[model samples]
Target chain A: MEVSARNALKGNVKALVIGAVNAEVTVEVAPGIEIVAVITKSSAERLGLAEGKEVYAVVKASDVMIATD
Target chain B: MEVSARNALKGNVKALVIGAVNAEVTVEVAPGIEIVAVITKSSAERLGLAEGKEVYAVVKASDVMIATD
Candidate 1:
């Protein structure tokens, strides 16, 4: 699929915490570095996300805030 | 800063393409793995995001969709 978002991190499904309306998915793109995504519960079920499953955390935001200290 | 979003990728500013109101920021978290974020021009300037500058790409989305094929 062709996505406009430039960031595409390839990783495995480390963990999935499903809630009533949302699900928190943790994708470990590298060692000790993980990307957590909050997706809909239905999308999680539809995608069949589970531990060790391979998936990409697609982030398409019009407002990506930058932080520096 | 305490953010609700779980995904926080640490990387250096690889590139920045500024537009009139929005700017595309490229953050290279790992080798061959980069994250692209679209942020406001003012925010970009406030954060002082530029090449070689280290920053964190904060993505807080209520709808993070999952895809599999």
Candidate 2:
């Protein structure tokens, strides 16, 4: 599928925590570099996500924030 | 400042494109690895963003998405 989000880091699912409404997914894009994502539980089920599965962590440019040190 | 977002990539602003209500900022986190972010012009101004300024590209876990190939 074509995704508009500019960032798409390929990684393997490291962990998953399912709550009432949201599911937190941790993807390790690189060695010791992980991206954590919180998506809806329904979406998690739809994606059939599980630990060790390969996935991409997507983030839109608009949702990104600029911060200073 | 303490940011709750897990991902805070350090980079320098490579470019800035200001629009009527939004500003697009490009941050080069690593050589040839750039992350583009679109934020409100007001926020950009408040942050004093400019090319060559060091900044962190932040994103909340909730705003992240998981995609498969």
Candidate 3:
């Protein structure tokens, strides 16, 4: 399911999406960037996870993409 | 430009591909997982980077996908 894609984004970056309460969302990004993985509130609570919790942000090289600005 | 994708891979992993001796390739992967970003040899060595070099492995959360087995 891997495909190449790109982003118009530049500079340090991170991603966050709204998540259901108690669920943790994985916010994806690289270090030096502000964010990476996030957990929804519900999932976070359910798993007893919280902010600054250590979760792995996984991606394959194939998933990495290059794009034009 | 990013999209969601999935992988069937398990356990720690790392990716390496042929590259020119001068450049460093970014092998993409997550922590706890073995491999991720890979740079071609030309890119890797050209940048004067090597293994254990700290480069951010970047990915947007939207780029990550969960799929059926």
Best by lDDT: 2
Tens digit of per-residue lDDT, candidate 3, span A1-69: 433422222112122344554232433234433333333454435544434444444344544432111
What clash count goes with each model? 0, 0, 57
Give the DockQ-based CAPRI class for model 1: medium
Model 2: pairs clashing at backbone N, Cα or C within 3 Å: none
- Tens digits of per-residue lDDT for model 2 on A1-69? 687898887889999999999999999877677889999999999999999999999999998999997
Ranking by TM-score: 1, 2, 3
User: TM-scores of the models, in the given order?
Assistant: 0.89, 0.85, 0.34
What interface RMSD does every candidate have?
1.9, 1.4, 9.1
Per-residue error (Å), model 3, residue B39: 3.7
Tell me the spans in candidate 1 whose CA falls farther than 4 Å from its real position.
A61-63, B61-63
Tens digits of per-residue lDDT for model 1, B1-69: 688865667889999999999998888877888778888899889888889999987777553445565
What lDDT score is found at residue A30 in candidate 1?
A: 88
DockQ of 3: 0.09
